[model samples]
Target: MTTLGHKSSMDHHLTGMSDNTVERPGERAPLVLNMDKFSQVTATVCRVSEAERAPIAWYICFTLSLGLLSVLGVCIGYLFLTGVGVWGLNNPVMWAYDITNFVFWVGIGHAGTLISAILFLFRQKWRTGINRFAEAMTIFAVICAGTFPGIHVGRVWFAYWLFPIPNQMEMWPQFRSPLLWDVFAVSTYFTVSLLFWYTGMVPDLATLRDRAKGKLQQLGYGLFALGWRGSNRHWHRYERAYLILAALSTPLVLSVHSVVSFDFATSQLPGWHTTIFPPYFVAGAIFSGFAMVVTLAVPARELFGLKDLITLRHLDNMNKVILATGCMVGYAYSMEFFIAWYSGAMYEKFAFMNRAFGQYWWAYLIMVSCNVITPQLFWFKKLRTSIPIMFVLSIIVNVGMWFERFVIIVSSLANDFLPTSWDSFTPTWVDIGTMVGAFGLFFTLFLLFCRYLPMIAMAEVKAVMPQADPHGAGAGKHGHAHH
Candidate 1:
């Protein structure tokens, strides 16, 4: 037993006991918590040895991802040389591959914000394990998504022309245009996401820096961490900043997609002009984004031996979210059909029909099965806990989400009010290559993150540890995953 007097150490307290206790003269009392391994960071901390991974697997991941990035480059170069003709967009379908890709990536980005910000605000202690990587994924996925619209414009050199800087050219990008709103929405989302991801990284970076040995390592971590120290005072302020930033990011999460919806909603196209676009788009975003996260996380968890940290419980939690959002999107589909018929608008009715049974009928069916029926497997706990099932479901969700975009873009334009101009849609190699490249781009960044960064938030995990708790609960401040 330790002394409980001034200038002496105190014994650990019982978990269920009241944190506060008043002692009469000379009475022995314990400090609030029993500091132990279980109490630390909820198993989120990477033991320094665990940080090392098989370098060859990492190399292969990087090489493939880089090759894809190069392919994306070649495709973009070809697009610049050959013009928009390469994408199979002609006649009434002025926007096809670019818009489809834009929506797809935006949807892929939603889960990161939900995992990092929304879950944090809810004080879901379970998020401590994978939130760091999820936030990182958010930043890179947005980068890939933001690039599509940027390069989709033919003149990649003057892509900045989307910016509304006052110039001698006497041309200001029209704020009234939905395209300009995309310019605003995407850029603002990217900027804010970058900031949010970086702020979350500061503490994690400091952990890495403390563990670093060399001079260059010291400087690298020092600069990136912005001179972070594990002072309680610093953490107190840093946490408040993080919470405020999360609050800001949550709204942008909604507004960015809503603005993207506005690009279609405000349009006059039969399929595009609908009030359901905003909420429908948001639900689809979360569904697709969460699926992508599982796709990426499955590999990382196994390859990195993070199964304990990224437990099956976490996957199950995310799967439930995916299932819920999938249903929401499916309901939106029914709502669209109902509204189309109820409104008695022939054009809208025809657009929904053409989506289901028109030239793109296969695309619509694929979307329906993947988004609506596929996630139903998640109702069984076994499917979610099974890695292979999770993997296949992830790919299915991504395919469906892509089809959702294709359906949105292709069906709307291919069979608009003018029957004379109606044309079917097909994606060219350039479209397919760029899509492949975006995956490459996402993985390349993620691989680098796994290599250098802690891949998990070490400090945040520590904060949830029983020792980190100012008030004790049980033997530790935090409970065990198994418990």
Candidate 2:
């Protein structure tokens, strides 16, 4: 009788209701909804990977992504054969689409680490739903970002020189260059993020291993599962490793993008040289990264039938972040002009003026409208909660961010100090194809990750669920009674 009463009280507390009671107006909604069992969570996430056939949408997306990947390959091959002259690299506009795309992709990679490491450290339970794929996105985005500098070096074979390894010729990388800083910063960020991502997935991989049917399936999943037996020791070590990796990754969330920003901030170019670039770049990176997350989350939830696991609450929270970061980006934008004018340097003032009303005024307009104006719509609760609205806004934010980099790079460089050397930049077919191909690479990898790996962190999600509580309901009885 005591056990029964205790179970009843626990159920009531977990559900926030009973037979005759109602949930209060201010009560927080449950993270997982429309599901009552841990098995259901397992089934929902695992089925996508386990199912023999994926949805038609997956095939359609895969086909398109593969085609684009081929385009990227062909473009890269052509560039290697024909030389960098194939790009629209003019006198002053030596840096254009390549750097723009590099920065854009690097920025895109930021949100995942922030969501996984920073939020995890803060004990944000809501991150459980989206962190898995976000980490995957981070890895893939870095892969895409790394491609640019590899090819941008022209002699792709000598790219190994970017590292500090000694050679027969005693050629060494210029350690002081921010460009070298990018090589180390980005590589370190990727290594830590990959470990953090794989560590979180171990238990889920073990779950998949147990549920796997065939011998081949068992072997494959088992290998990655690292013999995870869900024992107390296994879990204790996993938690420790995860916490340590999270700590290591937290500074990287700020440092990597800041290093990327240093590539420009360290330069003497009028618009490029700004102390604000570090924080500003970090904000824009997070801003664009969250937008990309939302961009992926919406379709993923709908297509994979993961609405219960990744609920509206998650989307709402992410949108709120987008809004907050969007504001930070906007503030950064205004400050650029303020500081330029405040400095009273003719060239600095001219750079700011030229960005708003110069040869590339159209790009500037697109950047402002997309980055500044579009995210403002999220200020309204109705719009923020609406799936369709947020998706469109997310994409728009990324487009604006791309243009933001374009305006920053092309505008400043195209019209440098010497009027005689000023040249209007134009992207050739190869330039457009290479950028598009990077997208293909990103999506192709993401689709494969979604198909093979658990998209949601099943272990973390379960940890957040009410039933996982040690003291709830059958706590005393379960402790006394053997399994």
Candidate 3:
């Protein structure tokens, strides 16, 4: 079975997917992945390369991604080989890069799930184009965000100490400890996200199987597709499953970030204690997540010749979200400030003031300018649609969001209640290098995903297409209605 879909030299349906020369097991009906541009069961996998550089750009992006992953691997391995002493961490400041990086990555995970799950519930049909990729980003960013905390404990093998195993020593994990709570939260977050992402991939994998060329490709895609034929019955069940998943994910999104915030709020430490922490962390997570989505998607859209599919309209809509969430996050910052002063706690007052005018004051101001002020550009339609402007702003947002975590963690902890215990922390090259390396871990995986997986959710996209709604144009005339 050398059946190739696109007639390309490389991708032939070689090993896995055929019952005969011209017919398949379900040839009596239409195969889901063989759909046309207007397909009600498949997305338009027809990306145009005339105005974009798909392969060349892939080369460049993957190279950079691989380099970053290598750096991250070395940094982590070195952290273990040399011990925790390699980093700038000390007592009272023990939560430095470990916690900051955790929050930063977890925050990065929020936007993708929000865009896919929340917007879907709202009937925002436009999410079809980028939602698949965005969800994939959510899963991967969580993977990257999660790795740091595990290794940050210095004894990488003993990372399991965070968990309660009911072992021989009668050493129960402390229920009162926020760190233990973080263990439950992050593990649950990862499991839920994985389930959400994989369930969505099934229909898209069916599309890939139909589009496959060679026996090998066919077999590989066929297995991954899990025998999907996209019958009406399947779509009915699929849609139901998706809706249920969305409902389930909404709470997880809110709870995960809120729980992460509690890792700080539950602390008796001056800067760490705050009542508004949960909602504040959630807002910041969404804000940063959207910015990151914009940053990655802009490049992917341009490079992959998906301009029409990922139109400027999509960008404009995302800009609006980024602005809205950014504003909410900014308000959270203001609320923190107000709470600190209103509490009249000397330790709290000092923590807030020192963060602004102290040794690490610049990080705070940078966070303010980038997240609070820069997103204001979205007020202009021109800025919202302009790729160059969006690209720069997106990058700035990432930088600002990273600083938000840094300011919250490092600055707050650097100088605590005891003046004698106060000391400024700086990121060593290893810390900076490893942090930089995580980007590699992210991009490399993303690049591979785009090539193999249909970047668009084919079935979901088709389901939302105008004709897919049987009552579309014939509504009143035919005594029915469009979706």
Candidate 4:
């Protein structure tokens, strides 16, 4: 119904649908399948949301997630009705499952912002296919993460005390406290991430609005689309806002994790006190985040029939990132040991030794093998490119990262300088159930998102299409010269 005379030509050129070939020289392997038409792209991505019924796997996963979420709820409710004593928290091991799960989910959220903000700033076009889903993952991961620290306070009702609220009592949070720092950092991150996600989604929502068949669908999408009308002015404004959000988000990716690390770094604990924690935590966060993305995306692309858009090339690229970050994490692990030994501090040296050969030696070994050793499989093209291998490895990476937190939190506190105060910690059923429930919560939100929202950003994907680039070399071949 809209004018396509000029746009159709551009689309044809960009999509490589016309005689004027848009293929770059030495076009090695196709990133996307050769079908690059704008209409096809739209049809492929939007079809999921607009489908008559979701795939059976979606229902199966959704139902399972709900069941697990219920378990989490029960666990939390029990904790509230009783007390923090329901957990296995002892004197030396006060932080166990709660802190471990908090750090794990927080780490999981990093890849989304890194891909959405950092990669976007760097002009990584491959990110287009996966950014939307990864951002959603980030948001859900943060929600799951935030739930932990809130409940970890024991008296959930007084959790608001962590916030700086001006009231009759006039109590304010201590700015110097690392815990308070986390509150501000995580809250700011969640806000900006949500805004960035929603802003990017607007134009695509507009596409849905225009294409919606039912009146309710049209109304729902129209309300959120903000009256987008494909005008050049609207496009210009949208791009500017998107750029600003991306720029803002880039530093946040670094800062949020850095602050999270400060919770440990500022401490006097042997294993926790270190200068390398910021970059080390950041690297580990990105490593785990990418693994989670791959884990989710591999199944999703297959089950959702999005193979062309979320291609093997995309998976391969993500695996490369996982490998790179995994190496960084491995290096950090090695450096930590070396630094401890060289520093000539008895407590520091013992802390490193205790971690590797202490009562929790199995946990440390799992962390090292999973985080450091497993990802080296990616050096082979066949392994990185193989979806099955990458998916399994991704899950392993998450497991390793979780244990990494456990090793740091429990191992350090359990065998500190004073041997008499040292003790081993075991998680209660409540602790286990609550941690498991966090996964349920994360997947539940993700499943609902996949069911309702466009898993892929259509407009952004289209923008990268050849026809969308008016001044490309291919445009000149199409009797259209760039001014």
Best-performing candidate as measured by lDDT: 2
**What global local distance difference test value does model 1 have?**
0.79
Top of the candidates by TM-score: 2
Per residue, candidate 1 scores C-alpha lDDT tens digits across 65-149 of 9999999989988988878778878888888888888889888888888888888889876677778888888788888888888
Error of 4 at 82 (Å): 0.9
Please identify model 2 stretches exceeding 4 Å from their true place. Answer: 1-27, 473-483
TM-scores for candidates 1 onward, in order:
0.88, 0.95, 0.88, 0.94
- Could you tell me which 10 consecutive residues in candidate 4 have the lowest summed lDDT? 13-22
Local distance difference test, each candidate: 0.79, 0.90, 0.78, 0.89
Q: Candidate 2 lDDT, tens digit per residue, 1-483?
A: 123334543443356321211224644356777555679899999999999999999999999999999999999999999989999998888899999999999999999999999999999988999999899999999999999999999888888999988889988888899999999999999888898899899999999999999898899999999999999987888799888888888998899999999999999999999999999999999999999999999999899999888887788889989999999999999999999999999999999999999999999999999988889998888898888999999999999999999999999999978789888998999999999999999999999999999999999998887666655523445553435
TM-score of 1: 0.88
- RMSD, each candidate, Å? 7.4, 3.2, 9.6, 3.9
| Residue pairs with backbone atoms closer than 3 Å in model 1 (clashes) | 15-474, 39-465, 39-466, 41-461, 41-465, 466-477
Q: Looking at candidate 3, what is the lDDT of residue 35?
A: 26
Residue 316, candidate 1: C-alpha displacement in angstroms: 0.8
lDDT of 1 at 161: 88
